[model samples]
Target: MYLISGAECFDPSPRGQVDVLVAGGQVIAIVEPGTLNVDAEQIDARGKILVPGLVDALTHPCGGGGEGGFGNRTAEIDVETFVRAGVSAPVGALGTDSIGRSLDVLYGNVMGMRTQGLNAFMLSGAYRVPAPSLTGDIARDIYLVAPVVGVGEVAIADHRGTQPTAQELRRLAAETQLGGILGGEGGTVLVHVGAGDSRLALLREAIEGSDLAPSVLYPTHVNRSTALLDEAADWALRGGFVDITVSTTKELIAAGDITAEQALRRLLEAGAPAEKITMSSDAGGSLPVYVDGELVGLTAASPGSLSDLLRALFADHADLFPLALAAMTRNPASALRLNAAGEIREGTRADLLLLDPAHGVDSLMCGGNWLLRHGEYLN
Candidate 1:
């Protein structure tokens, strides 16, 4: 058992000076400050912040893709980078390339993260229609597969996508949403936003015309283009969550369209609900700068950007309560169906991060185990 005190906790909401107790891999209790008097070792939060560990709701955790043969595929990441970034939980997703993306590979990736002490799960498909499936049907896989949540990153509006018709998209969404209900999880249909002229027309049609609740559509990479980002904001206004990728936001800032700081501010200013926006580092994924279909430049996502986004949010005077932690924690928890995850509350998993609020990650804990202490790995 452990007692973590002296810091405010963010379940994406402010809980002042909470003494969080952990045991048996779950957060057993949250006591009044100084409630526990055991000689049990105490780790101070240092008046910093204690938030439910950040969640990367969407990522290609097993090294995203290889548009250029096996050599082009990025290598899989280990536990160190994730913990360092304050990502105690991650929801893996498959990107555009699907040849090497197999259901078996996806399952192994989720289990591998669990082995290394992370809450891991995955969406079942890439950006294709007749979308890739482990059980031959989206709904079946969602109900039958353990880690499967919903179908995703189904590429729309991009040349790379299967360019699913509105009808096809509707069918997929209906199946996914139903499956999520049956499985008692959120049936989030993932979409990968690309910089195409059509923008989010297909998505809009799906929402406007279909019976599915708008919240079920989880679109990501909104910052890839200014127009796309705006479309994402509109989606949020219409009650859908948007995934603003860290690197894509960086590119936007570089182009003067908006800073990562501004992109967030815009989301809030638009009166979009706070919980409707989430962020992720497409870590272990490729960032290709394509010109005329020739890959001119490419960069793999760095784990540091997630921290950079959070730090930037704090630096920009953004509210720390919901803004700082939810994008990383509760929002993902709600979007993906990971109960007993997200938040620093009773009966939740003990995936936690302790920060200086001024500096950054000082210690990390997962499943009641101190994986990181004083900025160093315990084991």
Candidate 2:
């Protein structure tokens, strides 16, 4: 058992100074400071703040890339990377190079992370249809595979995507929804929105022309372009969720692309519901640069980028910090329908992070086990 005392906790809803109790890898109770006494290791966090561990909704756990060939494939993510980034829960997916990467390998990576004390999940498929699956069918994969909650990172409107038609997308969404219903999981079709000219037209069509709920399709990387961001804001306004990627480079920003923070601000300013917005670190994926329709160079993305963005938001835009935090926390959890995640609540998994005076991660706990303490990896 463990007790965290006198910390300002955000049950993602900001409960003032409180003490949190953890046992059996779950949050057992939360009480006013000094209210409860128990035999447990105690830590005084009077000067710090505590928040639910951030969730990376769209990550390349087994590594992504390969747009530039096998030599360009990204490296697999290690446990320490997630600990340092304050990511306790991560949902993995394949990107452009799904052909080279197997779903089994991705599942292995997720299970490995789980063995190391991180709460992990995955999506089956890459940037195309028919989506690659372990059980040969996307719905069957979701229903039979324990870690698979949905099918995602499927590409659209991108040069690298299969450029699936509206009917194909509708079919994918319908099947994914059915799988979710049958498997008691979120059967989301995680769409990878690209910089192509079509923007979100196909997704719009899929939502309008089908019985699928607007929430069935989750479009990520919406901040890659101004027009796309605008479309994403409108989508959110109309009751859909949108995800902004935090793994953007300065070059992309210079080219008029918005950062995750910028995108969040835009979404809020444009009257989009804050609960409908999410942000994720497209970590371990390749950030390929294109010049005049040619692949010029590729660089790896980091999960820490999401933490960096959050730190900046906390420092510079304190008023927006809760909303931003929600984007990484409650929103993604709700969007993915993940149980006992994205919030620090009793009966939920005890995945939490502590912030020091500098607004950096001072300690992190995953499944009630300390993975990082005082800025050092415990393991």
Candidate 3:
């Protein structure tokens, strides 16, 4: 049992100053300060702000990269890195090199995170058509695999992608929808929007030419280019979710593309619904630089980028900070259909982060256990 006292709570919706009580891995109660009479380990959060633990909807936890070669494959993420990034729950997926890494290994990484006191789930496939799955069938993988909530990081409109046809995409979305219905999961087809000339065209065609709802397709990395960002805003206004990657560098940002903060501002200015936008760190994935169709260099992404983005938004856009925070928390959870997460409420899972005066992660608790305390990793 743990008690967090006198923290300004943001159930991701701002609940003012309150004390939160946790027991048996669930948020059992939240009341006015000094109202709790329970026996538990207490943390003094008088000057801190409490927010729902971040849910990273897209990350290469098992490892991403490989565009440069086998030696360039990124390393798997550790539990400490996630805690430091204020992420209590993260959804793992495979990126460019799914063939070299097995679904079994990805599933094992998910389970390992669970044992380390984090709530983790994974997508079923990689960035290709006929998505590689443990059960060979994407639908079966979702329905039979408890940890698999969707299918994704499937590439489209990119030179690195499989160049799947409209028919192939329609079939994929249909199968994923059926799997979601049967498994009671989100069953989202997480499309990796590329910087190709045909950006988002295939996804739009898939939605229009088929009976699949627009919500069935979730396109990520939409902030990679100005044109793609505009299209993403339009897509969001039309009731689809657009994910912006926070793992960007100055070089990428200088090339006429916007940062995650800028993307949020543009989406809002363009009349896109707040709930339709999400932000994630493409953690442990490769951020490669392609010059004239040749991969010149690669750098690894970190989950820490998510935290940095949050602090930047809070400082630069204080008025819209709450809404931007939702992109990191509530919106992604809603998009992923994760019911018990993304908010601080009684009966929901006790995954929480405490922010210090500098807006850095001071402590983190997942499943009612403190993983980091006073800016230190407890484990």
TM-scores of all candidate predictions against the true structure: 0.91, 0.96, 0.95
Which candidate achieves the best TM-score against the true structure? 2
Q: What is the per-residue lDDT of model 3 for residues 126-157, given as tens digits with 9 covering 90 to 100?
A: 88898888898988988888888888999998
Alpha-carbon lDDT of model 3 = 0.87
- lDDT string, candidate 1, 243-338, tens digits: 777765344455544545556767777786778878777787886666666656666786667776776666666574357467767877877767
Query: What lDDT is obtained when candidate 1 is compared to the true structure?
Result: 0.77
Write the residue-wise lDDT of candidate 2 on 1-379 in tens digits. 9999988888777788999999999999999899998999999898887999998999997888887778888899998999899999899998888768888889999999989988899998889887888998888888888888888898998999998988898999888888888988778988998889999999989888567777888999999888998899888887789999988776778776798877888888988899999999999888767787676878778888877876787778878788888999999988887876899988989999998747588899999899999899987
Give stretches of model 3 more than 4 Å off. 288-297
- Residue 303 of model 3 has an lDDT of 89
* Residue ranges of candidate 2 with Cα displaced over 4 Å: 288-297
| lDDT values for all models | 0.77, 0.87, 0.87
How far off is residue 251 in model 1, in Å? 5.5
